[model samples]
Target: MRTVIHKLFFVWDFDKEEKWLCDMAAKGFTLVSVGFCRYEFEKCDPGEYGVRLQLLNHRLHHPESQHYLSFLEETGAEHVGSFLSWIYLRKRTSEGAFELFSDFESRIKHLNRIILMVISIVAANLYIGIFNILMCFFYHNEANYLGFINLAIGLIGSVGIWKLLRKRKKLKNDKQIFE
Candidate 1:
């Protein structure tokens, strides 16, 4: 049987999202598909597979991403799903463990990628919001309430960026310790 779940996970919530997917697998559901705010899972033996997710440096179709994914596949990981630049992979429990980044440096790089994506979103939102507000004032249009919506989104994204930066800082400190 297949189960579909509709949920929202912000860009900075990747760790939470990954943990939720693993918890679902522990309960006998294995992720099969992913989309904007939607996840599809198929019933499987509980604890049969280990789940891992990564934020790619490029889109799945890009040659660099394709090659990296192919490398992972050669190591016995199965590509489960992708949404935007994020990819989900699963490996049999018998494989011991599934980890996308084994070192602090690699993890830090992944965090950087996520931070950059969030920054882009924040910038776009703020720019659009300001533009709409200006237009509303000049044209005397009330329907431009979308300006407030965009500004709100920008504010939320800014919080996410700050959290990501803090996470990255911790990773860097940890890296220095092991170096």
Candidate 2:
């Protein structure tokens, strides 16, 4: 049997989302597909697979991304689904340990990708907000509300940017200390 779930997790909450997916896998539900705020899972043995989520540096269909995913698949991790630049992978527990990043440098690089994505979104949202507000002055009041909503979303993304930056900084510091 398959199960469908709807959950909301902000960009900054990716770690939390990963945890939830893993928890579900532990409960015999393994992810099969993903969409905006939607997850579809199929039945599996409890604790049969380990899940890992990554924010890729390019779109899923990009050659670079396809090659990277192919490399991962060769390593025994199955690409289950993706949304935007994010991908979900699963490896059987019997394959020993399943980890996408084995070193600090790779982990830091992953964080950088996520930070870049969030920053881009924040910049776009801020630009849209400003443009909408300016256009509202020449048009109608209703559009001003859209501007405010965009600004609010940008503000939220700014918070995520801060958090991701801190995380990247910490990873860099750790790499320096251990290396």
Candidate 3:
């Protein structure tokens, strides 16, 4: 029975995901936090104590007396600071396939995709523009050097300009940009 319990502990541990933590809490499975060999007992509350958060395998180094809450991450007890409880879980998201990206990364990826697409189109057009400019200047003997300058500027400014314009177009637009 003891061996099974220990194995179960390892299997149940998950990163500090809200949905999983919330579900575990709803299931009445209290997290037991124990200090390592050299460490000393800190506090009864997971909030007040500096215990480890949930690991990938659900089994943390829980020892004996500690506060376990239902909602927030399994790290500590209840507190206002728990708002960032989603941090650890989100941090792990990048390592796994079906995990949520952080707000900043999500935004950056979305913006990057849009920028890349626009740049690709503009780059093709820039090549076309350059071709036209060459034909006019060399073939027709109408030296328009300013045409190359404009093409350079367009390529450099493509990303920054599009991001600013599309960011606030609509609430749904931002979501759509990422997909």
Candidate 4:
């Protein structure tokens, strides 16, 4: 019973009617007796453009009920094409306390990807570090230049591991907060 801003017009109040139409359209014949207002809703009538009163119901706005909107269309309610689409606020977990576990799982997947990339890069760099040191000894027999390069690469790989350890600590702290 909520108030609706109607665009319908009676025969007596016909002059106030919209320019593009001559009969009540979306009023759906509810206003048939506005002083003999026989609804002459031609296909091109402006009343065809008004909102359907049924859409204003609270039932359609509930979180679970939003699913009905799509089902309504599928069941031949073609009129929904003109209305706004419904939204869903779905999450991976329905429970409030366990929702962060879902979030942590997503973050852990991202961390695993990063760890895989770091492992591949570090493995390649360590191989290069060992080769440079060995080449310095075997071919040129000079330790200073290649030893410094190997040491720098080793330190960079160690720093990468340290950064990953710090991120893991932060992730652990976040998971504990959820518990």
Error of 3 at 84 (Å): 36
User: Order of all candidates by TM-score, from best down to worst?
Assistant: 1, 2, 4, 3
lDDT (Cα, tens digit) per residue for candidate 2, span 29-117: 99999999999999999999999999988889999999999999999999999998899999999997888988889998888888888
19 Cα displacement, candidate 3 (Å)? 31
| TM agreement with the true structure for every prediction | 0.94, 0.92, 0.27, 0.36
* Candidate 3: C-alpha RMSD after superposition: 18.4
Residue 139 miss distance in model 4 (angstroms): 3.1
Stretches of candidate 2 off by over 4 Å are 134-143
Worst 10 residues of 1 by lDDT: 93-102
The predictions' CA RMSDs to the true structure, in order, are 1.3, 1.8, 18.4, 24.5
Best by TM-score: 1
| Candidate number achieving the greatest lDDT relative to the actual structure | 1
Q: Which run of 10 residues does model 3 get worst, by summed lDDT?
A: 1-10
**In model 4, which regions exceed 4 Å deviation?**
1-102, 141-151, 177-179
Per-residue lDDT of candidate 1, residues 107-154 (tens digit): 998998899989999999999998999999999987788998999999
**Cα lDDT computed for each candidate against the true fold:** 0.92, 0.90, 0.38, 0.42
In candidate 3, stretches whose alpha carbon ends up further than 4 angstroms from where it belongs are 1-102, 141-179
Q: Candidate 4 residues 113-165, lDDT tens each?
A: 55555566667767777877878777877564755676576667667666765
- Please give the lDDT score at residue 137 for candidate 3: 71
Clashes of each: 0, 0, 13, 0
Comparing candidate 1 with candidate 4, which one achieves the higher TM-score? 1
- Worst lDDT run of 10 residues, candidate 2, spans 138-147
